[model samples]
Target: MSRIGKRPVDLPSGVSATVSGQMVEVKGPKGTRSFTATDDVTLAMEDNAITVTPRGKSKKALQQWGMSRTMVANLVQGVTEGFKKELEITGVGYRAQMQGNTLKLALGYSHDVDFQVPSGVTVTCPKQTEIVIEGSDQQLVGQVAANIREWRAPEPYKGKGIKYKGEFIFRKEGKKK
Candidate 1:
């Protein structure tokens, strides 16, 4: 039995859920999101809660049970509270600023990097060294942050680059004299 799957996801006061076949749709204040589960698992909505159960006693069924449950939970959270990811820029003259729908980044490059902001997600730069990404979809928010960080990943030697908030870079020794 799957521990997480056994626990039903509770619907908060302003949130509602509907189950049709193998698909589950959740609507909340933030937005509406849906998930389609595999045939190995079943989805049901009852008493303002959603539950997932495996169709049979098999390894794949059990695996899908837990994953399906988590996916449903994420849908609920996404519609209700949404998701957010923060990035920090480190290095001299490296900064970030929002210009309309574009995120202008200065990561020590000769030319500024312009990142186009996608729909359904909002990117903000509270400070020159800070970037905050917010959106109803968790996956999109994370992907956007990753794409930005890819431009200038933090290096171990000087640690000069863009990185997630609270992330630590393992320092390496420099060349010996």
Candidate 2:
């Protein structure tokens, strides 16, 4: 009954997958990633593809059925092409720079904020006001970008702060003089 769970995940060229017990591991050009599914669902592999099916007619089994399939698909995409997130600094005196594995941010504060880059993710500042985060894991890439943006989130007035590229800031009117 789950539409998403019915579709099998296809393996592209140069990508490989192995399912052992309840764990599924995918290897590709970007990297190798794995996921362990719960007993509510069953996983099968054939012809460079993977499929998921519910173990019983219960609600939990159906829920896990679709989630497990999507997780497998994400693992395939993550290992093959990876993920990226871009952040833009839009305030005066707000900027960022990468020093080796560390990122230094200036957000109009008295002191600069130094962010240490963690393993499995790469953060780069192409320009003074631009920050780019890339990694094989989608969740890690998004979390790192969010952490950087949280340091100086965009405000309503004048929209001065850091924000995701193309993100809209709901502007509010200033008080009357």
Which residue pairs show collisions in model 2? Answer: none
Candidate 1 segments exceeding 4 Å error: none
**Candidate 1 versus the native: TM-score?**
0.98
- How far out, in Å, is residue 49 in model 1? 0.2
In candidate 2, position 62 carries an lDDT of: 96
Tens digit of per-residue lDDT, candidate 2, span 77-120: 99988889999999778889999999999998899999999999
What are the lDDT scores of the predictions, listed in order? 0.95, 0.93
Q: Per-residue lDDT for 107-154 in model 1, tens only?
A: 988999999999989999999999999998989999999999999999
